[model samples]
Every structure is written in structure tokens, then in C-alpha cells.
Target: MNSPVVSKNAEGAYSVKAPLRGIRKSCKYIFSNIYLYVDKNPVYQPLQLWSDEQVLQHQAFEKEQGFELTEFKNFEDIKEMSCDFKEYGICEVTDGSLPDMTYHVSTKEHTLTFDVKEK
Candidate 1:
């Protein structure tokens, strides 16, 4: 099994990819939202939600394979923290709300990195 890859692109978008395996095809599993943690503290004020359409699309893809990929674009809340190497980050994917079946997609101690710009 492959662990989730959490990265910040040059455009400052945060992307998380979690790989799943042995999921039943009949199961209509849906990922409610994603939570980003920096040093054990939540980054965003309000948790991000997956739209109904997005959830459906994700389900469709999961039925064919096993994995969920999500991206957060232009999110100011994570900008500074993502650029700081000293701060470790983690991405969690849950089926319902908190205290539910939460999957820690990223590494146990992953550090965020900024894209280097050549002068």
C-alpha cells in the first residue's frame, strides 16, 4: 500500500492523494472533507467540504480503482505554514465527521515545502 502524498505546487495549491485497497464495489463510500494539521493544529478555520458532484465523481473513480485525490487552491490559511520547513504537516481523510473512520494519508511526520524560484 502506498501512503498519501501531500504537496504544495508552485501555484500554492495543496494536493493530497490517498490510496485505498480492497474496497467493495457496492459500497457507496464518500469522503466528507479533508483536514490539514500543522504541528497538531488545524490550519483552516472552517473545514473544507467536498461538493455533492465532487463526491459522486470520486465515488465513480474509486469503484474503478482505489484512491482519493484532493487539491486546495489559493487557500491563504495554509500558505505560510506550507512554506515553513520547520513545521510538519499531516492530511487526514474521513468518511464522515471527526471521530469517524479517519485515514491519515500523509506521512507520520511530513514537512511542507515551498517551490523554489530561479532568479
Candidate 2:
């Protein structure tokens, strides 16, 4: 059997040192309030990870007819989406608190926060 070895420094103190950072395996996470749009402007706030699963479901919906999700930085890029919903929407069935409303998209490349401008 191999035995453990102890070493002392110049001060004659022996100790064991542990790693500072890596992998983040045992990290703790706390929830933050996720606000989609605020100030009634064309800008969208940053996305929090708490709702990441919901974002995935949205991508699946777009894939039903064989159209896979394409990541875009702006709301205008979505073929079916128009207007500054990221800021304000003046369309039917569009509301401030729609469960499916997203100014955020989570993708393999990155997560984007939107900033909208008045037209």
C-alpha cells in the first residue's frame, strides 16, 4: 500500500491545498426575477436560465413542419414574428404576459438579449 506524504514549508507548517475553480459541479444557484419587457420600449431584458426549458419547447414547435430553429439576434428575423414585441406589440392576441411570448432565445451558440427601437 502506498503511504501519504506530508511536506512542510519554510515556516514549518504542514497543510493540504484544494483546487479553486473548475467544472462547477457543486455550485449553488438561486433564482432571479425574470422580466421580459419593461418601460414599454422596444428593448428586451436578458434571459435567465430558470425558463430555459420553455425556450426549447418553442424551438420544437417550429420544427413540426421541418423548419428547424434558427438563432437570430433581433425579433424581426423570425419569419412569423413582426413588430417590437420585444418592446411593444399592437397586434391581436398579443399581450404583455403571453406564455409563449419570447424576446429571448437560448441556442447552442449563445443567449441573446434584445433591444428594440420605435418605428
Candidate 3:
């Protein structure tokens, strides 16, 4: 396990800030591969259960970025899964064209965020 970069504010609120360093090839890697720890339960994969259209859009975006998006062949596969984020708390995603980016997560106890940068 890796130690996450975390800190507390003057208000006693906690936050986790991780630096993501690498060139992620697809949307799956960007959304699913990254590790998200909530209350130390375990590393969470946010994009494991995405909508069919969401997956298609991701593939299109990846295609535009010169990546061979070859994961799901149809919408049925994507729609079959349900994305339930209740366990992770409130979440917000600032979709970026590039894989290297940042994330800001806000929970009742703390705010978690990560920065993904080019390696």
C-alpha cells in the first residue's frame, strides 16, 4: 500500500491529495484504474459501472485522442452494469480531454482530491 498525501485545514476538515503520474491510454484507465480510498475501506474504482452512452462517449473521446478504444462492442454490455456511488460520498468530475488531470471529492468528513500529471 502507498501512503496518500493528506492534510487537515484550520477547520479540522481533512483532505487527500494524490499526484497521478502517467499517460493513461483510455477513458477506462482514467476513470477506473485510479485508486480512490474512502474512510480507508479500500481502493475504489469509480468507472467500473458506467452507462452505455457514457462508455460510448468515452470511447469517442479516446478515439479523438489517438487511442484505440476497444473495450465494449455494444451498449448492452455497458447498460448491464449500474454505477452506484453512494459509498464514495459526494463526487464531482471535471472531465478533461487528457488523462493527466485532477479530481476533487467532497465528503461529510473530508474532501479528497488528486492531481494527474504527465510523467
Candidate 4:
């Protein structure tokens, strides 16, 4: 899996290019939420969950419209930051009776700390 690229444009808005090809293979997990840590503190926000089908459809749309970039136009003066993609779904081995499980596809190490650059 490729690490998500995070950068700040001239306007001070942040953008992230998170590749979903690896997560697409399973077709089981859905995008739950994004974890953003600024200056080592978790930034809380209400992020909606994207269903599995929705994710697949979005991926296809991105393929046609060029690279998919999720932009954050509300943050500035960030000294340090990191991000992680969280997903939730049922296990493949389950017999449709198990509970949903959550997993993290980190961009960096276990801490999900990635290098942020200014443009």
C-alpha cells in the first residue's frame, strides 16, 4: 500500500491523496473516518461513513476524473501532523453472524505519522 501524500497549497488548505486500491481488493471494508493528529493532538470532526459500494463507485469516478484528492480547507499554522484511514466491516471468514470489526490502514508507522510538506 502506498502512503498517503499530505501537502498544503499556497492558499493554506491541506490536501491528501490516499490510495484505495489495496482496500478495494477485499471489498468488505468501508471508509469509517479519518484520524488527523495536529501537533500530536487528535483533531475531532464528524466524518460520515462511506459504504463499500460508495467507495468502489468513488474510486471508479476518480479513475475517470484523474487523481482523487480530499481537501481540508480549514486548517493552518500546523507545525506537525499525521493521518490514518479507518475502516469497518465484517470478517471474510464470518458466516454472516459476526459483528463488525474495525481496522486501520496507517500511512506511517503504527502511530500513523506522515510527513507534511508546504507547497
Ranking, TM-score, top scorer first: 4, 2, 3, 1
Q: Indicate whether candidate 1 or candidate 2 has the larger TM-score.
A: 2
Q: Give candidate 4 misplaced runs (Cα > 4 Å).
A: 22-43, 46-119
lDDT against the true structure, per candidate, is 0.38, 0.36, 0.37, 0.38
TM-score of each: 0.24, 0.26, 0.25, 0.27
TM-score of 3: 0.25
Off by over 4 Å in 3: 22-32, 40-119
How big is the RMSD of model 4? Answer: 17.1
lDDT of 3 at 18: 38
Candidate 2 regions off by >4 Å?
Answer: 1-25, 28-34, 40-52, 55-100, 107-113
lDDT of 4 by residue, 1-119 (tens): 54568888897666676553345566634333444433312322222323344545566787788976333211221223223223322122122222122223422312222333221
Best by TM-score: 4
What C-alpha lDDT, on a 0 to 100 scale, does residue 17 get in candidate 1?
Answer: 62
Worst lDDT run of 10 residues, candidate 3, spans 74-83
- Residue-level lDDT of model 2, residues 20-61, one tens digit each, is 122345773322213332234443333222234455565777
Q: On a 0 to 100 scale, what is the lDDT of residue 89 in model 2?
A: 46
